[model samples]
Target: MKRKLLFGERMLLGDGTEAFNAVIPFRLRGIFKEEDIQHALGQIQAKHPWLRAIITHDENNIPWFEVPGNHLPIPIRTVMRKGENDWQEESAKEWQTLFNYEEKPLIRFIWIKGEELSDMLFVFHHCLCDGGSAMAFLYEFLQILDHPSAEIGVESPILGIQDVVPAEILNNRRQKLKAKFIGRLAATAIKCIPVSKKAIERKNDYLIHWKFDKETSSELISYCKSQEVTVNTFLSAAVLHAFKKVRGNAAFNKVSCPVDIRRFAPQIKDDHIFAFGLMIVVSANYKINFAENLYAMQEAVERKTAKLNPYITMMVMESAHDALKNFTKLLKHGKSSNDCMFSNLGRIQIPHQYKEFTLDTIFSPSVIGPLGNTTTLVTSTFRGEMDFSFMGSEGYLPYSEALAIRDEVIETVKLQLDPIAVL
Candidate 1:
């Protein structure tokens, strides 16, 4: 199976040089056999063609995902577990390590072997899949690892843009004209936008990890429910408030949030391997108090979310292929306007207890890319506890400042939890 890379895929793939990878680190409590791991991976690879495919460029130098007659199996590198922090160190190394896309698949696994407890990290090129896709992969892997004969269904992959946008919408002449006009206009504007000839110096990339105890997490959830706002909205407000409090005038007051395309496009299934997703920019109104800002931000989020049209957005982006170079240049050299991107994966549904092994914990996934700001905050609740992974570059956001911001976010949430009922 083969298909030309979509615009969004190409942008995330880059020139196939630097690493734009995502990692999902998790701990499991059991004795895992090598054969069991190999069997599970083979099943998964067989189920998802893209997981076993490699990237190859054609005449015009456009990348295509091609499944070869004899593609290599997904490689697993096992390292002795030195301590609890070994997975973190390995994850950092994986971030800087470039995938050999020409020969191997775009995904790999790192096994931190230990006596009783083991930590595993699933690393993928950002071009191959999104967080939603990765989590689905994880859930399946566990299911199969326990029972090698597990029946995970095959994926009817997305072949092109047509798969996502309906035929009726694609055939609409008015929509076609609008998409073309907007695309060309965007391309022209990007060319005219002033940007630094040199890229922003990303120095000393770092990750700061934290977690909220079950009690605190519960209280926060209760508070958000009481306010009639989502936990995501409340956390976004807290993050923005933290930056404004710590950085003062330097804060951007904006946070970029990725809207899962599956939510809008039913054609894009949870099992489908897709990289493209819709995005929304969120910001707080400083004129209002923190609680007021949460309500206001929630309203803004809902309004912007309601306005999203994945079909039109994809059409516009696909029309702007010629602008890829200029658009990438702007992202590489343009001034940073947002404080950071905040992603809340919400509650993970994967069971922690399995027949053979006990799933200990699922950490909040971390991702780093060369595009735009490297500062990002990701959170997800697993086992009734909320975990956070704050990743940033010292050049983009100093380690000291990032540390302070983490503390501030926690404090801000704790303050809001004061009024919530314990029961």
Candidate 2:
């Protein structure tokens, strides 16, 4: 099926910035041979249409997808080498490792076969897909690997935003008014804040990861339940506290949290479209105790988020696409005081048994946005454990400090429930 890309995805392609690129690595075990991996690639090519697509430009200079033919290789490239330092050396390459490809949406595969288990890294431009789509592709690829005789599933067609919104609906006066209001609010919010000094200095440079075992993960879930708050609320509150501690600012405030639009709108579920949805920013200004502050933060986030869901933002954006895009570029280049971005995928459900292999820990590197010197935290829960990974521009913030802040967040949450307990 042929479908247009989402507005956000289209914008990413238009800007042509490396910040929007996505890399998803899957650590696999119990693999037999190289041909087994090769066969999996063949099955993936047959199942996904994007794999065989090439980027073509229209008269307007906008890029769009075009299918070359059935013979097009699934955009998969293999790099096989023998030596201990090979994997270590290649992994250290630049985050946005460019591949020599004629197509706009380039998909490349890097395979490193070690002594016992093999590692597969899938890199693709964000213009084509998001983390969720990448994970779906990985899951399917694993399925094909487990059962080579299994029939490859039919490809899912891409559905564009224009197709989802009819022309008549786009012309509605009420929708137009709503879009105008949202755009004005977004613009005002951007103008009211001062650009973060750290962002201005361009000192962000460290990236670190912290994981919680099953026991600690369970404790966190229980703490949230007892506190009558969602996991995100608890985590966000903890992050605020940690920032206050490290920054030594009692007046700490402003956080950008990503809200997924897939469930907010049925039309957004189409696998082909890309959407950033609404950024829920929680303001910190009132004076209160640590626990009360957390509660206030939770309430602020929930209230702001309820005003307009992801669908509303998408509609607003669709109506004022050009204006919003221009405004966003200006904000990025100017001194804007947007503190950080926190994204929670909540929990991921992988099948207990994929063919015959057992699913293990899934780690996702944070996708940096166009704005420099921003802190992004992405969390995913799997197998009763929650994994939080932090990523930011390496020159503006120290990774070691950010990691310590993450641990402090986790520890503070644990202490709230069990003060005597060790996390």
Candidate 3:
């Protein structure tokens, strides 16, 4: 079985030179068997067809998820845990590890084994899965690992664009004409735009992670509720504020946050391994007080979110498939518009306690690609504690300044919960 790559997926698989990987790293304490880990992966691959599929290009060089009669198991690479930051070092390396898309599944696993505690990293090609779907895979792996007999129902994986966009819409004559016209216009416009003459040299990417205790996490949630704003908006406000303070006036006041398409498209369930994303860019109004800024950001988030039409966005992109190369170039070579990409995987629901082993910590997922800007802040609350993984490159953001921005973000959050402390 073969299906054409989506527009977003095509952009990710561009030239396959740079690593476009996403990783979910977590710590577990107890005895683990290598065979058991392998077995769990087998079960997951059996249920989700994409986990067993490889990318193959046609005569036109278009990528497709080609399923062979007999698929090979996803490969696993294991390393011995040396220190507290072993996973961090491995994560950095994983960002440089490109997927062999033509041969193996677009994902791999890295195990940092220790006597008492072990860290497991699930690394996937960004084109293969998003954060939510990755979390689903993690949850299922834990379930089957803890109990070999556990059943994870098979996923009727999305085959192609038809699965995501309803058949009725695709069949509508008017919609078809509109999509074709837009696609042609976008492609022509893309051809007319000038490509960057200067090549931006690639830089070594880094990941920094930290977490807030349960008390602090709870305080943040309560504070956001008291202020009538969502945690996402509050974090966006803090991130913009942090960049402005640390980078001085040169920082862009805008921050882009991705909205899970699952929220709007019922066709793509939580279990489906899909990678199309819709984003809303929120800008901070520094002229207002911090409290007022939060509210203003909340309003912006709500208004933009309401205006988002995932169906239309998908249709437009599908139409602009020919312009995808230009789109990828535009993203990687164009000037950086947003200060940073802030993603909040609000309140992870995976179970922490298993029958045999206990999950100690789930570091928020971090992904860095060879794409243009490297500044990103990803957050998640797991086991009652809020965790963060900040990834950036010195070329884009100096390590010293990134550290200051991280500290400023924490301080900014605290100031909201405790206003008097700011003085």
Candidate lDDT (C-alpha), each:
0.92, 0.61, 0.88
Q: How many clashes (backbone N, Cα, C below 3 Å) per candidate?
A: 0, 12, 0
- Local distance difference test, candidate 3: 0.88
Q: Per-residue lDDT for 307 in model 1?
A: 98
How far out, in Å, is residue 231 in model 2? 0.8
Clashing pairs in model 3? none
Q: Could you tell me the lDDT of residue 67 within candidate 1? A: 86
For each candidate in turn, give its C-alpha RMSD to the true structure in angstroms: 1.1, 4.2, 1.7
For TM-score, the strongest prediction is 1
What is the per-residue lDDT of model 1 for residues 1-423, given as tens digits with 9 covering 90 to 100?
A: 899888999999999778999999999999998889988888899889999989999999999998888957889999999998998898889999999999999999999999989999999999999999999999999999998999999998888899999999998999999999999999999999999989989988888999999989988888889899999999999999999999999999999999998899999999899999899999988897998998889999999999999999999999998899899989989999999999999899999999999999999999999998999999999999999999999889999999999999998987787656433
Candidate 3 ranges with C-alpha deviation above 4 Å = 419-423
Give the total clashing residue pairs for model 1.
0
Task: Give the lowest summed-lDDT range of ten residues in model 3.
Answer: 414-423
Per-residue lDDT of model 3, residues 104-214, tens digit only: 899899999999899999999999989999999999999999999899999998988889888888778888788888878887876777767654655667888889899
**lDDT score, candidate 1:** 0.92
Model 2: residues >4 Å from true position, as ranges?
A: 1-6, 17-19, 74-94, 99-105, 149-152, 166-168, 171-173, 176-206, 250-252, 270-273, 284-286, 309-312, 352-356, 419-423
Candidate 2 structure quality by residue, lDDT tens digits, 27-123: 5555457687678877776777766666665686655666665446544445554754343334334245653334433566667665444556666
Sorted on TM-score, highest at the top, how do the candidates line up? 1, 3, 2
